[model samples]
Target: MRYRHILAACVCVTLATAWHSKATDDIAELPPMGELSRAIGPMVETMLNGGVAVGLAIEDVSGAGMYSHRADEPFVLASNTKLFTTAAAAVSLPPDYRWRTEARWEDGSLWIIGHGDATFHIIDGYSYPDHFLDQVAEALEARRIDAVDQLVIDARYFDAAYQHPDWPRNQLRRRYSAPVSGLPYARGLVRIRRGRSSVYSTTGDPIATVTNFLVRGLRKRGVKVERARRAGIREVQPPEFTSICRHECPWPLEKVLRETNAESDNYLAEHLFKTLGAEFHGRGSFDGAAEAVRVALDAAGASLDGFTQLDGSGLARAENGGNRASAATVTSLLRAMSKHPRGGPFLRSLAISGRRGTLAHRLDKGPMTGAIHAKTGWIRGSLALSGYMRRDEDRVVVFSILVNYNAPHTYDRRQVVLSFQEELLRAVWDHLDAVDTGWEPPPPALVQALEPGRPAN
Candidate 1:
């Protein structure tokens, strides 16, 4: 069921009362933020004293105000930026959207076109069958094409610029900063293990690597690839190329989103981001993707003010200003999403605290454990956690917390910032228990008197 539907009756009652209630009366009835502020104030102050900037915003799921401290100010989102990217994708792409790897026989060659499947193979602890290429091989063998004159890898679906320009150049080889390409094999990652040493490598040339991998797989399956060469990836459908087979990524878009947000998969996030651009804006470039996301969010009733769309993975930080998003902005976005037709799937895609994803080890033993489903992000001195929390069966809250530490002692300060964030979250969770709902059943006497045959007091 959509989350908004679950709460609609309660929300409608609240709204109905608001229509007749005085504005001042409504303001007076809101749950006091003082207790929560007081509980979390020292923790926030400790971070501030230690040279950290914290942005926090919290509200009931109905978009009712709860608390705010620097919540309107923008801070670097780190991987929290994935929330925006994935949300936009969930709205733009259909639920069945699957990255397609198409193979066709053309001019004495088998052409494999990559549509940039991020989950092409097992990576980041998610197990996918290692035999995607084997399936293609089997398809070719069944067609009695024992040998192909050449194997052509068409990877031009996305721009040739593999890596985002704003990413840290030094970290390009790491799995987290893997390049984005039209054809990403093993999520563009390769691992080499020696007798005593192991190393990880990101494919510098994704199309070439995938092409070589396919050749090796086909040969293993008794299909001969006499020659393999790279070809330009294009969106144009080749009418002359007869369809041989199509290999689909293991997971659909929903699972892709779950993995992206839960594990903070940079490659998947960027791949989907570019896909958004390619599908909606007619270009897979970064600018196109950013604009596509903006358009999607705007269509969803989200405010785009002060929001900057950089790389989909949130690895890029603004050079002149902070990558800003107000707490209200994020909460509103979440609210809109919860009410969206696809809200159930989209909300389920987030990481459940203490259970799985990036939050497996966090909030594991607290009152909030198992109640919070959020996206966690960390980049040097920046940290973010934002998502929904079921305070109880009857109460739900949406929150966004972003912390940026300016201190040079980042390693030591990170722990302090994280502690404060956890403590603050607990405080909010506790505060929800004390919140007063303006809705109460009418007095028993009044109800009885209103009945047709009841006597008045």
Candidate 2:
């Protein structure tokens, strides 16, 4: 309740990160931000009795009039932590990076080396990885590779620390908390069928699972393997190995980001975090990944000053091991991404409120319907809605609403917190200081100001 940077609602936008639009960049000059502070100040204060640990921040691409309340204080980020991981990835890594898994014909043996491809599974009964393996099988068939001494599966690109240390032991078996690995299948989770429905659960060992999958794939295609096993990290293969086929996941990093942010897949999130570590720091462990995230975000203009990231996914408790960031810091990343030339994809990666992913059903009813594109985060005692709200190509804003509620974690309080978030967003739309298109209603204050001879300020 201590911070405020208010700006009146004025226009709509095509892209959420289209802040660099020169045509309407001067709209910030129309209204004083103080007007926004006065409008939403009381509305936000009344929620103290229902949910107290409220944090909020809203800003346009120019970083103007970001309504900030408790913006500087750190709050628990649940799945909202994916914002940091994905943003860092978007800015720091190669834009066209893909997850590569290769099969090689080595000295009298076949070898498969995996480099953190999470989409290595069949979808709608079509397996892309399997097809690539069939290509290898065809090459083997032509070479008269009747028998091989070993079919070695090597996932040494990532260290063997598949599970994060901070994850809850009780929840370890759940699909959401599935472990990360250098080589993953269906993002380290397996489908379990029950009656007419099914659920995903953690596969005990990702490497072994992938190994079995590849072994079956080859054997089914008539490539005989006498022994199949994992290759050691330090054991170097001879230089005589010929590249049979190098299969990369289709639009792999794009798919990973979508699954990580939109689907909120913790396994893929962790895979990305550790993979960043491997790519940037020469070590793929959790610490190395943490270092990589810090470096990446810092380079991209979002300082991790007060941010504490225990894991890539915000499954770890805030006070326990989960990541924490201030409302100001979350907005800092939003503002930074808005200016980043390549940040469009990261902004677009979020779920549309009324239409898609985790936020599909939440804000569908009112003016905010299909307007909010964001990541939703929820743990037992915390809830967050952070991302962009774009109505047209003129008025795009980035925001973060984080709340650490009182105990019991009841459904009613959850609704209260979310209601607060929607109202806060509605308030932002009200004050964004842009001209209306006549079909959609402007903010109440703007409507009043537009009446008769009143001037907008």
Candidate 3:
């Protein structure tokens, strides 16, 4: 009857803590980092031994920065780049935005046109694999149309770049690197679970596949589709077709964004990225998306002084000069999102530590379980964690801990660096989760002491 995904998200979110608006007063009450510093001295030393490049920043949403260690230096963001893209999209796109597609009948042809919707079967899925197509067939049946001479899958709505140029050509077939199209189903990937197993990944051209799938569906529904093919960008115009049925994504922008951040979905991220450009620049392409993102950040008052964006999914790596940003830039964006009208959903979208998404297993559970809501990113040489840590009930703090372990994979330092990050946050959450009674600005000695190889003073 409808499509259903066995692993659909079963999540609960109550949105973000209210924005902390008393900036000046909060600064006066800023917490001291002395305790956090002491707790991380050994951890940092060990990571340094393993050849790690650390960039950390922790800031009070209602106040100012509490501690910083080379926080201004830009580092490869990995999937952390998703934070910026999603944040920008939150601000620029309408709060209630939803993607839509239409099926049309014209000149004895059936045409399916898409406007950037990849959300299918991931949430509350339809029972049938392609319920939307079935619905189209039923609609045609209701209209007493028995057959169509041709079926066309039109994906020209989005540019045919298909894949990001900066992405490694070898990894194009990986599920994480699934190609994007104007109209996508199941994030443009077909699951290959075997004998009750849960894992799956294989790539196929979505437009071509859907066209054929729909043809079979129509044939099964007592309609004959003589031919099926993908439509080019300039193939069909408004006057050339008559709308049959239109379908809108069941989820709104907020919910889609939750999936974007919670699942770290590259396909959703890229489509939304291009949608931004299409909305602002009248066409969906990498360049347009980049410019639109900048505008959104500018509108949010988030600074990207040293940030460089190449693609939406942060799939770009150091070898090809991927997305880069400073810890300060990350915190700045988080802080702005806290006060934004859409901040609640934005915060709620982040993956929870020891609870769900990428961090469901990390942070070691216990009091820290479900308490830390953040996004985790990892690639060959880089790892990033950025988001909010609830101070109590109505308050929160923002932080970004980015590490680069590219020196040598001979003995992967992932465990060591990961331990450093976990213990550091554990200390912040358990011991120094509040402001210092009497605090002062970070001194020159402290800043100098934190310079990578240098010992803490």
Q: After superposition, how far is residue 410 of candidate 2 from its true place, in Å?
A: 1.9
lDDT of each: 0.73, 0.72, 0.72
How high is each candidate's TM-score?
Answer: 0.83, 0.82, 0.82
Task: Report the alpha-carbon TM-score of model 1 versus the true structure.
Answer: 0.83
Q: Model 3 segments beyond 4 Å from truth?
A: 1-33, 121-129, 190-201, 318-320, 410-412, 430-457
Residue 457 of model 2 has an lDDT of: 19
Candidate 1 deviant stretches above 4 angstroms? 1-32, 123-130, 192-196, 233-237, 321-323, 436-457
Taking all chains together, the TM-score of candidate 3 against the true structure is 0.82
Off by over 4 Å in 2: 1-35, 191-200, 318-321, 434-457
Instruction: Write down the worst ten-residue block by lDDT for model 2.
Output: 5-14
lDDT of 3: 0.72
lDDT of 1 by residue, 11-32 (tens): 2213222123333332333334
Model 2 over residues 1-457: C-alpha lDDT tens digits?
2122111111111112222232232232223346676666665554442324567777664566456666777888989999998987887778789888888887778888888876677766888777878888888888888677898888888889777767777888787888788777766777789999998888888888887877787788877778888888898976898988887877646566877887787877887888888899998887888889889889888857689887788887734446899888888887777667767667667777766678777667676676777899998778998987775554666788887754565555566666667777777787766422222332333222111211111
